[model samples]
Target: MNTSTPSRHRRATRHIRAVIQILSTAMLGILLLLNITPLLAYAQSETDVTELGVVKLANALEEGKITSVEAVQEYLDRIKAYDKKIGDKPGLNAIVTLNQHALEEAAELDKERASGHIRGPLHGIPVLVKDNINTADMPTSQGNQALATYQPKQDATAVQRLKYAGAIVLGKTNMAEFAMFWDTVSSVNGRTYNPYDPTKNINGSSGGTGAAIAASLAAIGLGTESCGSITDVSSFTNLVGFRPTVGLGSMAGVDYNPLGDAIGPLALSVEDAAMLLDVLAGTDPKDPWTSEADSHKSDSYLASLKGSTLKGARIGYVIAPFGGYDYSPGPESDGIFSTTEDAISVLEAQGATVVKIPLNRSWWNKYAPQNASFWATTGHENFFVRTEATWPKGLAELTEPKDAINFGDIVKGSPKMEKTAVEWVMGDDKQPRDEAGFTAAVNARHTFAQGVDELFTSYKLDALAYPTVAAPPAKVHENPGELLDSEQFGTHCGWANFTGRPVVSVPVGFADHFPVGLSMLGSQFGDVKLLGFAYNLEQAAPHRKTPELTPSLLHTAGSTGTTASSDPSTGSDEASSGNAPFTSSSGMSPSAVALSLAAVLAAAIVLISLFVRRRKK
Candidate 1:
């Protein structure tokens, strides 16, 4: 009876199989459409840009994975996506201006590549410069309205070197007005927001460059730091900011708030920062301060990035620099207590041995007043004229820390203004300092550097680790008040500037969900080694993470009544699951699929055995 019904069974089975094939193909088509659309979009989206250093880019170029024009276009598209204004709305606004000639320059680079000529690591890399640095091509506005339209006649020494190294200038970045304060704001340009969280400030005169690099807007960018300008900004924005020992690079054409300032590089990765620093570091006759620096320039910094360099590195931790200072009774000398322990904790946990060391804050307080007196006493008359009377008609009152764009205007009026900005802090008629504050600060700087140097000698330290500040970045409004009055964290950063030490700031982690920086200060001219050490520590700790701007999906997973249990042996437990059998949010039972697969295989095996027995009979 079974043999006679075989033909009928085969006909019914064929009809069912045809239905299944039709449904399966339809489902496959829908799945393919769903997958292909996003992939195509991802390929088309300009956001696929890699935020790599120049060295990495060069490697990719040589490997034929990326074209020079494509790399430049990726960065330009990112800048266009993140830097423009839609309306009364807001975005990152990290870039102050985009290089108009970037495409043309990139075309030239591609042409050079076609001719079998490679400039170097930076041959096709795109970089951004702080607005204070003269690019000659882009307008150099020092984040002030006065210089919004001012353009330099030539590149800064730093910029010239970058171009010679084959790097492309992507644009000019915004900064604090005249690089005057820790908080970043500019009358000429709006504020720069943190890339991880747009609601938060990026932190500083170099904030724009930090945010840009963090968001993958450029390969690298130049940032000038007078005090905590670079470090604090780097910390909050999760980027590498290097403040090279003063005069390690020429600052002749770089705009300055006052006379003395250090221009450096900021990048997404420490390697990229090293690449830029290597190319730009050297002496220049135009800048007198360059003579004071140690002539230990290297052809490339990447050659020295040995991860094993930190194996036995001793890291000094500064709990408080102004903890016990008793000199000035002003607000600038006030103490700030922190909710979290200093950033040294993060550094210590990451493997480097950390030692707590207290600094004499009193010496710095005394030095501050003495230094102010010296500035006032030496230039009182000139300061009064600049502040009390306007030099040119229609010009605003000349003040200390004038805009770099209007610097020329001030210079045109009087030679003194050309030499120094008109600041009332120092006047020729002021009373002489009871104590030599400037000398004391200078001496204290040497003392601080020496104390750490000796500590390094004693411990065979690679670098000293310290908190960029006692706390996370202060509010933008609070920056001015703290700078003018008292800030406990001021000396934490200023000491590096005082000693002309190479300090690299890495985003240690978040305190209260806000970014915090741990700085690595190395011996004089130890920039490359210090950067390598910081990079390794960063890899070990991995403190920085993208901010959660919206409600986490895990919260939604927890709200559901289902409780998925994790397999303890595999460490696969759902963090939100209670210890019980849990239903999946996706309506599929996990055990059902396994049972169905077993049944299908069993049926096939039984049919095959029957067929074999029939043949044998």
Candidate 2:
């Protein structure tokens, strides 16, 4: 039950560093005489930490090159270095609250690793969760100032799955207020700037995860996508994002509109995403939507990655401006489109049959209006009225859980609410309701999903590919008073969301230094197959580059970090992606903690020197 704050952790690390400095200074003369620069061999580990992803970090832990404690502390240091305002510039502000007991949890995981009981692929990996997702130890503020101190009774279903898998819940990140905004601007934590370009806004509700993971603040993070929240920001920030079928992942304990909300991973690569999905994709008794999960989900999404290649695969590529909707402004559209075209050519070069799937302009024109009706007109009120509803009750001023959540009461409870969010609770209710229109919209959606399915069937396609986000990152000032980015020319998320299908986004390339992601969608319950295609694309065309804004910091296991990729993607089409070969059966008898300390002892002295330099600055 004992926990420690960041300051306390810092004091402890400082004490360790002080002892290291004294020992190192005394041994310096002897070490220098012998030219014992053991730490310098991997002195670049701290700087190269940006190069390591979730899978690589996991591999390091399994290999005894690092421990969960070192990895956790490394990310914490990165957060301290870059998350808040530092020097003359604005920081990412991605992290909303640090989990005080993260180090404690990580140390325990290390003990388990030492005891030879590995939980799963995520053992010891650090993750940043979106603030809207409930964590028992942290407040689930939903990015509203009024609910800033609102603590949930337990962790969300997805969070429980993560902890059970041995992942560290490092902290909570700021998110779009109520997961409703296009830009992640919260009244409690303000806006999260894109690390790709701090002046621009990465499209959100999942912006904090986008920025944090993009900047290497954590090994990976979780983000909820109602529509394009997960993929859009991931596209903007150059990270891989997956939005599984609506019911594939649980939404219980997460304050979301059940109509289209789903929880998924924002990670460095498709391999890592699939690994996380293995843990998250399952049926939850608390959520009725997940009833199909146990049936639909594969035994291991990672298994799908084995021997999966795009060669001889039928991939339907969207030749854009296809539906008379271009994804960017003027020349920028052509530039981004050109970038995507060049990347898509890799699909063919890798022996995949790339079939052009041009969407009809009329289909899109009618679909837009129908989509609006489906999202805006139905299910919201009733969904909130269900037993899962907790809005009004979460507000500090409104303690009665029995009270119905109303806009007027919500606005009254949080007087200093973000302006854009206030419209949700402060809007006039005098507008007429259209039951007939909603019914028609629902009918249209079914027909649309069926038609799209026929297209896949007719084409014999495994997945359909398109530009994830139509445009590059938008300037923070570009969309004033708007919930959706006004500058976006194209986005295909609604196609997957309304159809209840699986979709994923991976970095294709960069345009003028801004990241662009390619989206591939599959039929409902075909998440495993979809991931295989993405894995092929990821391995063949790895475009992920570390953000320049936030680099690295002094780390614990600097000497033990891997230079070559431990990525499972290195395997051939028929072989498993070499996923750290973890098992519950006993192997090494030596204590993992002892080995981790011994492995990094030489490096800790180097880290101390770096730490002192950082402090002086």
Candidate 3:
């Protein structure tokens, strides 16, 4: 080989060779970064944006790895991408009216953070409130067209509390029209499809929240439960739902029976739910029911998450919760009832004792509340008049559940209102309501709850365990036929509602590719302790799978995170494969990252060229 070049050109040749080597190394580094850097950032930032539970999201925001605006924008992007109908079929349809000021609110929160004024863990976090909960900024439609234009005079007490903690109100979600049915069909927003499978029902009235949060449209959400709205919807979507003991929080601005409907959190994990409950559970002067909140509440529900485990816990397995059906949940199907039997080993592995309390259909049938009549709108005369007073004269109608929006106008406007809505609103409100029916219903609930308490005592149990839903959620429907008759929303959930006890529903596993949930019920105001126990089960066997249909919209070319897999390994704090651990690293756009690398390489080439020119000179 020719070893030597002319001495005159030798220095220039060496410089040119050095430039080639540098170019090669830099190109390789860029290629590596194109794969590694973007992925790492996506794995951390964009993935976290779309999939992180509230606790992780808050940490990221506080650490400055993610700005509130970025988080809010990511959610807005998801809603735009997946929250509408696609290919003639309904999409998640989770969100209704998005807060126009969401970005501004986020920017302000970011400013507050930069100025070193952190409100709390919820500071700068985005959340979706159920539409029925009044938001001063957005119309509180309550999922009815008549009230679609009705702007609330003030935020719901809960909304005010959330904002005070520096949480951004992302938007309101759809519900069963007037919250009268188990399915999330509304006159205004129409039907909310399950993100897990768009063909299925989301189980109202917090169904919109269920779909949105499941789809990662927001970090966490608020839900209202008159019966199984929170737990069942959460069950279908494979999220953790906490139905706080009635009066644990105020129901003042919510558009449902104050005596029956309780507002709660629907979140990705037990920790997030507890953190939200920490901010939300307190006394409100507007709600007389919440007078006992100060007395019964813990100092911080988030604190309850510390070092929680199932060790030394006793759980009662109530069998008859699913009554009067050909459905006998044995060791056969892998649904909640069946898989819950599988949880025994998981529970026992975590040092918990499980007892089977086999109360048959007869016992359950006997305790059923007679006047738990779905039609009765008892105790709502004041609410009706109040709503009618706010209604515009042009939209005048029968001043009945009356006040802000006239029911006559509501019925006429919502010509497509579900039959269940028609029956509950018109049949009861228009007719002579039996006031005693409500009283008897309340008394019956007391009797049922007392019996369950006795059962808990007999079993020496810390909590009573049952399926969140009696069966898997039914399909979405045009006719109210099977939707009304179905026990899919959970027949046993009323036991807690009537007795005013707390229940936390966690995703246990999947049956037939759908999530099956296990609910743990604690004594009234025993919410904190029950939460810890539920957290243990969640740790033992996490079944949180991000829905396939509504995946992260991180990039046009590829996916951000893999779907969550059920890790049957017990006693591990790690979430599934899809959920990456939280990190304090911000993400740059792919184009920005690419351009930055290009500029660096270009600078190196320029420097080499100058050296060669000097050598030649």
Ranking by TM-score: 3, 2, 1
> TM-score of each candidate?
0.67, 0.78, 0.81
Q: Against the true structure, whose lDDT is highest?
A: 3
lDDT of each: 0.60, 0.72, 0.74
In TM-score terms, candidate 3 sits at: 0.81
Question: How accurate locally is residue 566 in candidate 2, as Cα lDDT from 0 to 100?
Answer: 22
Which stretch of 10 consecutive residues in model 3 shows the poorest summed lDDT? 575-584
Off by over 4 Å in 1: 1-47, 85-89, 257-260, 292-294, 321-351, 360-461, 476-491, 544-617
lDDT (C-alpha) at residue 93 in model 2: 92
Our tally of clashes for model 2 stands at 2
Point out where model 2 deviates above 4 Å: 1-48, 319-329, 365-372, 376-405, 428-441, 478-484, 555-617
Candidate 1, run of 10 with poorest lDDT: 546-555
Candidate 1 overall lDDT versus native:
0.60
Q: What would you estimate as the lDDT of candidate 2? A: 0.72
User: In candidate 2, what are the lDDT values of residues 303-410, reduced to their tens digit?
Assistant: 789877777889888744223443324665665677677668988888888888766656566554323455444234342344343343544235333355444445
- Model 1: per-residue Cα lDDT at residue 393: 41
Compare candidates 1 and 3 on lDDT and give the better one: 3
Q: Is candidate 2 or candidate 3 better by TM-score?
A: 3
lDDT of 2 at 326: 33
